[model samples]
Target chain A: MLEVSREMLAKGTRAGLKTTWELAKVVVPTAMLVAVFKASGLLGSITDFFAPYMGLFGLSGEAAVVLFSGYLVNLYAAAGSIMALSLAPKEIAILAVMLTFAHSLLVELPISRKAGSPLGYVLIVRMGCSLGAGLLLGVILS
Target chain B: MTVLWEGFLQGLQGVWTVARVVIPLMIILEIAQGNGLLQKLNRLLARPFRAIGLGEEGAFPVVVAMVFGLTFGSGVILNHVREGKVSPEETKVIGTFMALAHALIEDTIIFMSLGAPLLLLILPRVMVAYLMAYLVNRRNQHLSLPEGHHIQGIN
Candidate 1:
């Protein structure tokens, strides 16, 4: 049992290190970009444009950045954006649920197709579930 | 220049925080996999999976994806489909559910570290994915495509 555990620990550490490296590659660069956007005041205009729609999900306009990153780029990018901002826990929770249902579309959609699911079907289901999750969580949490 | 520098520093800090959460979680997941925990989980999930139109074979990929993330999970799925262990209909159901809720542990932890509520983050996605997949399975059953219309083996 001890031997098995030691092997598990070694393997887990290796996998952990690799995964963290992958995450850092995305998170650090994206976070810096978002911070640049915030510092330069670009984020404000972007926020203003998205605020009303975001309000439907009980999130601030700034959350659009997180959602956009998660949708187009990947979840680590979304995390970077989230770190650069200050949001209430409630809004974070809402974004969390929404993104879980529909992040990383450009990559995962094709993977689904290659697994025998249609591209269009996966796309619609993901986006629909994301919006639906956001809406429902918005109502319940608010 | 100051703004850029500050941004770089903040990004590093964020990476540190996220790394603290991610690395440990990955280790725990690895240990679980080493213990054959996933097989037990697959068995536990098989019945509920069938309610959404997946079989014993289909449940493995979905469970793997739910834990590991879609990219890895889809590899198992593709292998199973190629082996004829999972049908097109089953693949569609797996895709629907996994699309909505894959990578549950890692994604949820990342959000939780950012102050998202844990239960709120997980429960809703699971519930929504199950409900949506169940609905799609029902619809697929009714539509029952003509013999040749099934997506000829995925490339």
Candidate 2:
């Protein structure tokens, strides 16, 4: 009984730390990038280019910032960007789905590549899925 | 004095709100991993993945990573890779698929909060992504891998 209890406690502590680590990846980047990107106005330029293309997938170009940024940062950063901007309901949903399949290629790639799977194919699949899902939904609803 | 205090209060409130949501999610995902339930599920799903020449046991990591954020969900996969249970080749493939998509839970919630149609948006989103990744990974595996390379990073 004592052994079981001790094991459970140790497990709980590890879980807590792991979760904290995951949350921090999101929260920290969001806190830092909020002001920087907002002030830089670069988000607008990137969105303008991606806007028409993203609209092909049922989203606004401006919303592309969240999707594109999702790859460099994590969902928290994407969420932060979403909060900063005023996205249409449909646009927000589409962007959300697009990011779901692909986020933070940089951070994840090294670890994944180290794991030794096909890097290029994964990118293609996610991008294809993102575009397909995004546009199909965009057309039907929006 | 009043404005400064007000600002401080709002900041504190914001932090607290974020903390509330993030903390619970982290804990739940952690338990999901710690209990070894994930591995059992992965082995079950591995069969379908194997039909395409990918490992069936990958199902667990892919599902978790899809539902949770990669940071939150990839621990089990990482543990396996380190233990040499998964070949490095499989890891790269899984990593790529995951990079393109993971953290389905938090993601759909964000969309829900943003006023997207959860049923229409979230459901098809996962199905399509998973399908695509599986197909692409399978098709691409026909290529000849370099010879004389021993798999690395296992214990």
Candidate 3:
């Protein structure tokens, strides 16, 4: 039993390291990119544009970063962006719920299709769940 | 420039935070899988899946995806579909639920690390996924009803 557990430990550690490496590749680049966007003052304009729509979810425009990256890229990138921003706990919770329901569409949608779900159905259901969750949480939390 | 450097530092910080949670999680998950714990969990999950209109064959992949996330669970899920273990309608239901609620542990933990509320993140997603899956299952049932059967025959 001890020998088996030791082997499991070793295997687990290797898998852990591999996952960490994968997360780093996305998190680091996305964080850096957001920072550059902030420095260039472009983030300000972007946020200004998005703040109105984001308001429906009770989030500031800054959260557009998290939403966009999570939708197009993956969750790790969203995490990286969230790290760089200063959001209220409430806002963070809302974004968390929203992104949890829907993120990484470009990658996951195809997988759903391969599994026999239509691409349009997956896309619509995920996005609708995301936005609906955000809306409901916004009202309740606020 | 200093902005770029700052960005790089922030990136590293984000990676560090994630690594702290992810590495340990992977280790624990690996141990669980290695010990056949997942099979036990799968058995436990099979019953509850019926609440959302899934059967035994549909349970395995949904359980795997719920814990491991869709990308990682895709092999099991796709294989089941290809092997005709799960029906097309069941596949749609699984797809809907997994799309909303997969990777519950890792995703929730990572977000919790960012100071998001734990229960708030988890409960709503689970409920929504369940509700949506139930609706889809109902729709599919309605569509598949035998010509002579009334809509009320669904139960």
Candidate 4:
């Protein structure tokens, strides 16, 4: 798979195209669900439920959706939610930190698989670290 | 179909924002990859990573991929791993770390519009991802798997 090699270059290009098309297909269906969720305002109550914990992380209720969704989907989906919602400076910064450490389960899983990763272990470790670090950072910042 | 239409419209919306920035930046980074640079950078990072149990060469691509945006850039990095340029162990470490957090550029930019400071989020995330990756890498090194599973790098 040496990208410098001609075959890799072509293969990589094709893969990139496949990725783009795949992303489009996946993102749309997901986004529609997200849109409905937003329209119904179910997220608000959920955000409210998580607000205190998130606030402990120095983020707002609205931001929980952004952080959680970003981890479940991709950054774009997270951004789409962030865009439609109103957040304070503290909230967005917290999100930035949360996202900085995690995003887009769809993309990372396949790559991990290709690399012969023990995915469950890796994910568990990463999740624990990300949440702990995010909380720590939030405490320090707060 | 409605979902498709809605998604289609949202996809269009992406063009004007995060995609515009992320796509260009990814190209710039790819074009900028250099063997000499990778070699030198890997050497410098080796000691730090050695302490964490990672082979030297795994440093830069994973770091850059994490610090940048994950979707596209990380995908590219994944492509490299598949090519055997990054070993399975290294890939695990990188994947573990980056999975925790990657794509700072797009995330920061997107959040900034909603009122967050780009630096505030970026700095903490990078440091945490690196630190956690190092620790996990160190922990794993103590328990060796079968040999010959190592992925070769370009340099």
Give residue A81's error in model 3 in angstroms. 1.0
Give RMSD to native, each candidate.
Answer: 4.2, 6.9, 3.0, 7.9
Tens-digit lDDT string for candidate 2 (A1-142): 1123445556555655565456456644453454355456775677777777776777777676677668677665676566556677667777777776666777765655544555676567666766676667678777
State each model's CA lDDT, in order.
0.86, 0.61, 0.85, 0.61
Chain A TM-score of model 1 versus the true structure? Answer: 0.95
> Which is superior by lDDT, 3 or 4?
3
lDDT of 2 by residue, B1-155 (tens): 44334433433333444555555565565566556756776776677667534566555567677665576446868777777777655665566556655766666655555565667555775556456556656645644332223333231
By summed lDDT, the worst window of 10 consecutive residues in model 3 chain B runs over B146-155
Cα lDDT for residue A129, candidate 2: 69
Residue A8, candidate 3: how far off, in angstroms?
1.1
- Put down candidate 1 lDDT per residue, B4-116, tens digits, no spaces: 67766777787787788888787788888888889999999888988988889989999999999888889999899889998888888888888888899988888887888
What lDDT tens digits, residue by residue, belong to model 4 across residues A1-142?
2235444445545544453454455445455656666667787688789988877677777677777778887766776666556666666666766665656665676655554456676566656666876787678778
Q: Which regions of candidate 3 deviate over 4 angstroms?
A: A1-4, B147-155
lDDT of 2 at B7: 34
Which docking class does model 4 fall in? acceptable
- Candidate with the larger TM-score of 1 and 4: 1
Lowest-sum lDDT 10-residue window in model 4 chain A: A1-10
Task: Kindly list the per-residue Cα lDDT of model 3 for residues A77-99, writing each as its tens digit.
Answer: 99899988888889888898899
Model 4 chain B worst lDDT window (10 residues): B146-155
lDDT of 1 by residue, A18-102 (tens): 8788888988888788888998899999999999999999999999999999999988889888888888888888898899888
Q: Is the docking of candidate 1 incorrect, acceptable, medium or high quality?
A: medium
